[model samples]
Target: MTQEPAEVFAAFRHAESLVARRRPLDALVALAPVLAAEPDAPSVHLLAGRAYLNSAQLLRAEDAFRRVLELDPSDHYARFALGKTLQRQSRLTEAQTQLRMAVAMNPLPEYQEALGEVSARIAVEGGR
Candidate 1:
């Protein structure tokens, strides 16, 4: 079913609020129609990715984050989110690469901290 742009925007905002309130599952439900309506919107995908990540749906989170990057390569937040999803899945090397790019692009303290964490994990695991 097709939806009006205003409706999609409203759903997106509602979904964003749900995610912020820690109701990720609810956010995902609210996002479904928005995703269907605006599959190419980086903001929508980023919001879905955050919901997925919050809900521990790591693979889906990774996919959503990847989609955001595909739409806009310079999205440092997407890179950081992808890194975090990979890190949670124990894919430290891949996570490290994404985190490095994120930090390089924006140098946010959170990005730096996440990169440091993944790097430390890799170092510890490599020493084994």
Candidate 2:
């Protein structure tokens, strides 16, 4: 079953709206068709990752973000999201590495902030 690109993009927008409204499960549900139709699409995976992250599904979010990186290694947003997911899971070292890479790639304020936060967590948790 093939879906039109426009339809897939529309679903993505709908899912984003659902996520922004804090209805993660609903977002996931809304994204189902897009996910099925565009399994390898980085934007679809990124949106799913965000919904999962907002819902505290850390592992799922991590996988989705990783999938985006696997598809496009230069995707700084995916790196930042992966870093945040790892941070939420208390994998501070991994988070720090990803966040650093994201900041180096894009130098966005959010990426830098996440990197700083992850580094602080490592510092505190490492007892150094």
Candidate 3:
């Protein structure tokens, strides 16, 4: 049986709250049904990316964010998230590329900050 849109969204909201609470496993559980029903939804993918990131599921998070970017390259948040995921995985060069793109697209303070961090890391690693 197909679930109602409202129900799916409600679950999504619940998952979002769980993520905010640092309960990523719970968030993933909350998201599962909606994910199954709407695998291609950008919102679902974004939330899943966030949950996976918080849960330290780095590869899964990267895939989720990459899917979002593939669907909507103009999504600055997705770019930022993907950059952060790469950073967590110690892929500084890839992280910097994404962060620079995100900064050029939107110039959010957070995006700039992340870029600066990655740049600083690169400089340090180069000096070493």
Model 1, which residues run further than 4 Å from truth? none
lDDT for predicted candidate 2 compared with the true structure: 0.92
Cα RMSD (Å) per model? 1.4, 1.8, 1.7
Residue 31, model 2, lDDT = 100
lDDT per residue, candidate 2, 12-99, as tens digits?
9999999999999999999999999989999999999999999999999999999999999999999999999998888888888899
Clashes of each: 0, 0, 0
Per-candidate TM-score against the hidden true structure: 0.97, 0.92, 0.95
Whole-model Cα lDDT of every candidate shown, in order: 0.95, 0.92, 0.94
Local accuracy of candidate 1 as per-residue lDDT tens digits, 5-36:
99999999999999999999999999999999
Q: What is the lDDT of candidate 3?
A: 0.94
The residue ranges of model 2 lying beyond 4 angstroms of the native Cα positions read none
lDDT of 1 at 73: 99
Ranking by TM-score: 1, 3, 2
